[model samples]
Target: MTMTFAKRSGLSVLALAVALTGTASTASAERNLFDILFGNRANRQRVAEPPRQQPATTPAPRVAAPKISAPSFHDYRPEAPVKVDFAAIAAALDEEDREGGAAPSPFLEALAGLAGFDLRAEKEVAAALVTHYERNPGFIWVEGAGLNDKADAVLRVLNDASAFGLLEGDYAVNVPLAASAVLDTPEERRQALIRFEMALSARALRYARDAHLGRVDPNKLSGYHDFPKKPLEAAAVLEVLARTKKPAAYLQSLHPQNTLYAALRRELKALRASAEKEIVVDTETFVRPGSSHPEFPKILQIIERDADAAFRAEHGEVLVAHAGSETYAQELVPVVKAAQDLHDLNPDGIIGRRTVGALAGESKQARIDKVLLALERLRWHPSHLGNRRVMINAASFTATYLEDDREKLSMRAVVGKPSNQTSFFHDEIEYVEFNPYWGVPRSILVNEQLPRLRRDPGYLDRAGYEVTDSRGRRVSSASVDWNRYGANIPFSVRQPPGPANALGELKIMFPNKHSIYMHDTPAKELFSRDTRAYSHGCVRLQDPRAMAAAVLGTSVDEIGREIGKGRNARRDAPQKIPVYVGYFTAWPEAGEVTYHADTYGRDDNLKKALAKVEEIRVPGS
Candidate 1:
């Protein structure tokens, strides 16, 4: 039978060959096994035996092929072939790596990644990054291969966009290519670098000017640069610039003869001189007892102290404390007792924490700041202040009649509650009414009396309010639903002209959008309180009849006669008085700063806004 050959498994043959290779003739045996596994069956039958080979007489000298070198991982160099000091290069690499650059230029790293690229292309991108850094030294460094790719990509975009020039429209090309250039001569390159740096500086300055940052007067800039700087002066200069059409011309005119920009220079010099003068005066002056500089004694202080004490006695502890000694309590006691005489409080020597807090807790500096703010507000007031005036201090709860800036008479007043604060404004007293019938304001009718009327239908009748129909016939208060009546009440409720009426004895009218007027309230107990917030927005005088009599230049009886006749007394008075409702936390009284509570809490709001403005730090600062 003919011997047939079959294909052998490569794994099985390799294993047999490995086992056979340990014996002599192992190479020949392995070759035979490989031929048997690969040769066709018909061919295997006819296969010829190997020819007798000549045995080697001597072993040839073993020769080894040249060792192939693995690619060097540490031999990376930039395409530009720039000479870099290893230490400096390493430090820069470390910094760049720390900042994110692990591959090439920081700008390229910022670009993140790019697939298609060449060495020369990367070098060009590196150059642009160097230029950008030179232009904007303030720019923060980014790191990593990703960042490098990003920066290079962005640089390419910029270069393409700015092919014609460095700057285009509002944008500018900034790439620092020269930083990594390998020049033939180091000295010449160094000189060129210095020139380039100088050009960059000049460009930066020009950019600042174009941006209007350098529009400020040079003198003002110098003033800001100087020691003990008055920073607010710079703001004032800016304000002046805003108000004027030509800021440069305005600055130039401040020094026509090329005098060192006189406005800022002169102002700064004056401020310094004033400061020196103040220091000298401060050393020389000896403030007298009860003088304004150190302290001032007033009757109001005593009243405040006693009032505080009374409050402390009633409640467990005093609300506020005096700044100085306990002696302020003693000093305040008598004065408070005197005010108590007017306010109907019992005279007492003990001035509690509340009273002392009210009197002495406020500092002089706080008062000055308030006055300054008020002065700023006053700048927007109208220029034509009337010759004859009535000034009402809403804080003090008092009004003064002034003729030619001289006080004619002063009277007590009851102002609005802290929540319903009296508005700060001026108005002309056009008319006055004696024995005026009360025409209730809509707000008062809706908010106050309506609720009471809803609960007790007899509220109006008990309060002497007479409800009348269109035909002037009296109507029963029970017929109305006070809650719904605000919308449906067609008839007017008029309080008859009597001393017990809501408007008291008189009413003074001034036309304003707020519907605010001066009148007298039947609630006499309100005026005796120190802090009064009793009125429904309008001002209530302690003695309205006296005020009306003074304004009309007539006797009280004649005013009563006019009202009794019910003639719409349209008599033209000889003079029209100006009335001002003002807010003043601090004012000069006996040459001292007299501080009052910020009853409306306006000071706190203004203070917070001012603090926020101060926190901002601009470039120069």
Candidate 2:
């Protein structure tokens, strides 16, 4: 019986070793293995004799025939061995091992589907969402075709978005149960989950961004507004939400933590709670303290209403005595003065439009509007405006220096007029210039000075302005052709340091692109006015020496001494002090929210802008 051979396991082992080792050529190794197992054609004649003993051996020796040559291993030389990639081979094996190619993760597919939605316009948000889940490929808000506790927590925080001055409707989202009621199939249920998941993430991101950076983009309000719109990363938001046990707390943490913001929120709550009807005083005529007017009784009533409880207790008799009188009585003067003081006015007891606006106090809705506006404006600025800084509120016509968040100095200020609105922005106070030369701004030169210079070419010369050509060389203002320039003049104009200088004795310089600074003004009487928007654009501090001292971290006497030298000199502040030039119609002052006239109508503009934003956010609204 004959047993035919088949390819054994050893053949596969030999082939694997040959591929792995790569030590010799493939052809020679295979041939040698075959020759070793089964005799080659050339060596077939050589046969082994069994036990015939010496007779058999003698018979084979007698047949010494043709010479035969065997294959030699020493003569074989392998060419360069091919390099093998173990990792690639292992990966190929892994692929072959997997039954069907890995199925796409349904969760990841839902995340990628965000690109097809409205998020396409919100590029930052889309990118962040995709990146977040790719890093953490798991469902956060959903669990097994329904919403999880985390989603419930997020919705709770979003429902109370108004507490942070954000509109609840902007972050409004419906629960997946609504979708579940409409769909019965498993695929539709999954589709509902995807929709629910994306919507939640989008709303959470919007809330996170709006809470910290404000709903209204300050830049879009008007050219006068300047602020860097802070970006909120969606990935960062999702990462925090996924990791935190208290999702509501994490969501609420997005609001600004500044004291002013906190105070505004409290004021908003109070205004919403109050039932007092707003008093409307429509008279354009000014009511002097002692002068009688037809509307005096009405003005008195409004003043009494706006005054604090303490004022009412202390001067209850005075208010009661003039309660029905038409004349602006001496008894009623204190009441008007107290109301003016409460609202941060001149407190001169002259009931003009500004005084009336203050005394009448805003309608509940109006005050709430201002508070909400103030809160939004606060969000535009840094949360922590360093320990030592200066805050200039243009609407209130005041400048304050705070050290360690405590008021160090507060004084009256004159800001830009309506035509030349002081910008709403922030910068660092770098230095103070004593007896500073005022470079006539191009705007002033083109609009005001050029027109004068055209009528009389020697106006600047008469006005004591120093004119120079494009170079630094001083040139006669009369020599230049006034008609040759429109807005772009080759000549530069500036006022030298003198008593008649526009900037009085000293100017605190932050050196911004707006060319605005806190400076002393020759026009001291402007600060006495009820509304002090008089400068070209810079802030005119009533007490420049005191402000200088505060920013320089020195004494007022030292600041006075520097100016007394009567020379043009600049003194750098001890450290850079933050100076925020802002336009806040409602601000916290002396532990109370003081309302100011919206001189530039920024509040109205902001109101309109927000309305448009809401309309876009909620299409039918």
Largest lDDT belongs to which candidate? 2
Segments in model 2 whose C-alpha atoms lie over 4 Å from true places: 1-121, 131-136, 178-185, 277-280, 283-295, 304-318, 329-344, 347-349, 619-621
The TM-scores of all predictions, comma-separated, are 0.45, 0.77
Please, what are the lDDT tens digits per residue for candidate 2 over residues 304-354? 665677887987788887786877877777777777776666778778888
Clashing pairs in 2: none
Per-residue accuracy of model 1 over 1-621 as CA lDDT, tens digit each: 112211233344444655545434656556545554564332333323222224246634432222222111121121221211223323444465668645554332322211111111122223433344433322121222112232343333333322211122212223334444443454434333332332222222222221221212222211111112112232233334334544434332322121111222333333334422110112122222233332323323333344655554642122234333223444344444554454333345333332333434434344446654443233223334466777777766777766664556777788777656666667778887666777776556655666677677555654556677668766656555444444445666766666566676667887676667888787988776656667756789887767777788888777777767753335545666777676556532222334466676655644553343223212111
Q: What value does the lDDT take at residue 463 in candidate 2?
A: 54
The lDDT of model 2 is 0.73
| Residue 542 miss distance in model 1 (angstroms) | 2.5
Evaluate residue 534 in candidate 1 and report its C-alpha lDDT on the 0 to 100 scale.
70
Best by TM-score: 2
